[model samples]
Target chain A: MAVTGMQAELTLGPIPFHWSREEKRDFYARIADEAPVATVYLGEVICSKRAPFFETEIPETAERLERGGKRVVLSSLAEVMLTRERKATADLADMDGVEIEINNAAGLLARAGRPHRVGPFMNAYNEDAIAWLARGGATHVCLPAELPGEAIAVAARAAAALGVEVEYQVFGRAPLAVSARCYHARAHGRTKDNCQFVCEEDADGMPLATRDGRPFLRVNGIQTLSESYVCLVGEAGALAKAGVGHLRLMPQAVDMVGVARAFRDCLDGRKDPAEAEAELVGLCPGTRFSNGFYHGVAGYRKIAADAAAMADR
Target chain B: MTQAELVCPAGTPAALRTAVDAGADAVYCGFRNATNARNFPGLNFTPEELAEAVAYAHRGGAKVLLALNTYPPAGKTALWREAAETGARLGVDAFIVADMGVADHVARTHPGTRLHLSVQAAASSPEAIRYYCESFGVRRVVLPRILTIPEIRAIRKEIPCEIETFVFGNHGLMVEGRCSLTNYVTGQSTNMDGVCSPASDVEYVRSADGSMSSCLGGVTIDRFAPDEKAGYPTICKGRYLAPHRAEGYYAFEEPVSLNLARMLPELVAAGVHAFKIEGRQRSKSYVRSVVSAFRRAVDDIRAGVAPDLADLVALTEGQKETQGAFRTKKWR
Candidate 1:
């Protein structure tokens, strides 16, 4: 598994949480100065109302990351339901220079024939979807994490023929779902329109525990995410073998710089994957690890590597 | 205004006939495989069943639309392709597709065929709808359960294809074709597997306190009191503990059904070409009642008569309903 000559490029996905302008600038500033990531995605991929809060900081942040020698990709809202959201996507689509990562079909349609990246929200499940996206000027695709490794390999093979880059998320809480209604605001007894930015309270995500009092999921604004962070450091070699060129790390509340360093070490074969996994558990305190979606099991369930590796085959 | 088409769901061949005989203008059904959205056990039509279904629907002046709406896995598109080819051969009226790959295959192989975009595609904007129409020559698109009447009207003015909207049954607040909440807890996906919180993994337990609890993959989704009605533990509709509430909260949504009978006139005026009732996972009776209720309502709207949709609450989940995001954003 450690034998693949292809070094996995680590990319930072957009921060899903509703972080303040100062916190986001500081985070990106540190990411620029310290992180080992090759690419960084910026923009509001969740609620459109949150876009104004940090829209001004995106260019400055993108310039900062670019100055740090990382490619910057601007992302669109995942659920483009409102009229304002549609306008925002059209505006983003009209922008030139930086590549846009389309999360919703509205963005994809708006940016037709333009070089862009397909975010995981687009649901490129199979080779056919990849081919379709590639034909529509998609240069790269971050596949839905619900897909198993074999599926990824098959998609990668299809994508390889079409000359499209494939990205697999190796870290962070897998974004499970996006709804029209804001669950974060709903939980706080408010509506999507008048929620008063209550989502800012949960920097990581609001935990959604089961009736039995077990943490099952997390809510960040309108999105529902898996409770466990997808820690695929143990399977980086397996993913690379599956023709995955880039391994994406979603920006979590954890120390992403250290997280990237540990994955970079594992991918470079300097540190064992198991050691990196252990290192990540220590680095991100109070976080549970899961890689079951990689193994074709319940995404929140962490399976043993022997079973996981076998399942990938 | 002209009477809009009354679209209905058909989980089985019986449901198809029931909806047609009960006055559905169009009936949508999927194969018994994952190619369709409602891939539940003991539901959906076989290829042979689809042939008879087409014949029956055609005889009754109702159309049969095949729902090839689920995404096929990489290296596993044969099923979806075969389903579309088979449906085309069976003389089905149209193919309701979600995945672009499936849409591409349908457009190329079955030329001059009707293609309706499934809500599972989650194409919420006019530009997105136009993209599908331009790329695949889509005839219609089932609008996702997210937009308001104004948004729908505004979207209608921009796209070339006809617009269909959900009027009754399960209110999926989560955008279809993109949701993976069930996949996280059960490894079963709505977009891929066409099953959410799949029946195979579902369990119900009763406690000594005369309370009932529903779980999926051994994780408790929701609990019910002795006299409280327990709805199916569709993960999004279930209750969960959040710091905002000590007892619990319906973080995503409560177990409420979307009954937009009151908004039919507005929807029709908003340029809705079809009104879809979503309950293929439900029984034939549910199909019959919902389709007929909506049928009369659509007719009443056309006749300038107020609809009598009060009895519809009996057919809803937990016998509770809401206008959802269609009436107001405050429902969010």
Candidate 2:
């Protein structure tokens, strides 16, 4: 848990979109074989209706990643409303040989007395809350993506003191909110119960634009994500210095292995942070990039490094 | 019929007296600080005002619930701790809290005080609700504005805490306490600053073509036609363009108020212990009229008669109201 002299581990966060089961299998197959991530988070973290489609393939995916020398973790849904969702989360607690990442409090209650990771959606914003979760057997916690750097440092220090590892989202679209109503289904002129799984049509998620035609967010079933990918490749050193023990890269419909490599290289000091940022941009064409949330500005605003450095001073 | 308690919003000392006079079983208010969600300028109660308001509500045989609901920023939880300590010292009936740190502080420091989980906590499932009840001794949970009545009935059977539902006011479609869209656009968030679409950052401009546009943080959130009435510039309620849609539509939710006055008996039968109203920044007349209407509705339900729900449109947002997700599962 010591911040200094500790190499930050690169982790692939759970996929939040709805892709085909075969596509998911192929994606994980490539990730396991080629990605340089130290840990892999699998399972559905969005709507429960989408879980059954991929549930059968999870064990194989986990096994393949484990064979590739990666630690596999299963993530619970962010919002658990249906009874079946609750049951599925409780069932995950009994799964052997893998840790669980709890996005909802229901998962925490079900996995009582067991070591687990608290996902970003659980809202551990302060030191006291992080300590509380650590007391409840949480070994790691991914702080919310909207937090600024100072807050992250404070929480990271508290977690480090409690012997808990703190992870921060460094790539992919930041998940901003989750709701009971499925916006994707509603957009398709269907109800959530009988929508026929139309979210599968958009691999990255359906883009939401402002009235002026500015891409503002992406709608994936019940969750809303920032339109721009949150790229902290430029701040790897700063984040590590802030005591962040892990850098999480959420999976998207891009060259994820390349994305993982860029982050891995940047964190390992094998490549310059600016060069890694350029490589990431080239990997995901036509997507905006942002690191403003870390600078305590609007999430969509990308502050220039020199300006950010001056502000830090 | 079982009687469900009516919880009304008291934004100020005057509003507290007005709600109590109009027959509120309990009034919920917040200190004038960032600790509460309705942290608007010229609204909420000062510490002295809150102390006086609690005394006034207690004198009228009603309870006061102080909302310390906003998540405290890191390394600055003293504000929330002070609010809880002040509320406990002033003899408030319960503390409506959202953050785990605030809840833990209140539970540990003021063990005798009741803790009601705010809707902002978004505890939708029984396991999540029970976690709060078991972990922090939360006595009741203001259920999120999402669950259907059947879902509430199922949840009530599973958890050991009282259930509270929003009976009237803002129909927030987004998950409470989790949304950072405001911050994404305006660099301020309800979870951190207790303000969503802060009024100072809102702008309404009348274009030369006779159309109107509502803007937030310099971004045009929605546009209104010459014949259409403009709504407040909340990020969630605005119309937005999406793929495969020609025109902009309400991607999240429209500007509609939630009016569940007709479902009182059904909610009571579903084991709802309290019905909460959602406006703390509304006028004193709003506090009085809405609280009085629900008060009579509850009484009429107990008397085995149909409750009247007319003349509420004038007070609704955008002058439109819906039952929201209370009676249906297809609200999206």
Interface RMSD of each: 1.0, 1.0
Docking outcome class, model 1: high
Model 1 residue pairs with clashes: none
Model 2: residue A237 alpha-carbon error in angstroms: 1.2
Q: Give the clash count for model 1.
A: 0
lDDT for each residue of candidate 1 in B66-130, tens digit (9 for 90 to 100): 89999998988999999988998999889999999999989999987899999999898888898
Model 1 agreement with the true structure over A1-313: per-residue lDDT tens digits: 1226137789999999999999999999999999999999999999999999999888889889999999999998888877789999989987898789998888877787899999998889999988988989999999998897768888988888898999989899998888888888888788888999999999999998988889889899989888899999988887787788889999999899999999999888889878888899999898899998888878898887777766655
lDDT values for all models: 0.88, 0.88
Root-mean-square deviation per candidate: 1.8, 1.6
Chain A TM-score of each model, in the order shown? Answer: 0.97, 0.97
For candidate 2 chain A, which ten residues in a row score worst on lDDT?
A1-10
DockQ of each: 0.82, 0.79
User: Candidate 2 on B1-332: residue-level lDDT in tens?
Assistant: 43588899988888889999999999999988889999999889888998889889999999999999988867878989999989999999999999998999999999999999998899999999999999999999999999889989999899999998998888898999999988888888789789888988899999998889999888888999999888888888989988777599998887888988767788989999999988888889878888887788787777787777554434464567888888899885
lDDT of 1 at B16: 91
By summed lDDT, the worst window of 10 consecutive residues in model 2 chain B runs over B309-318
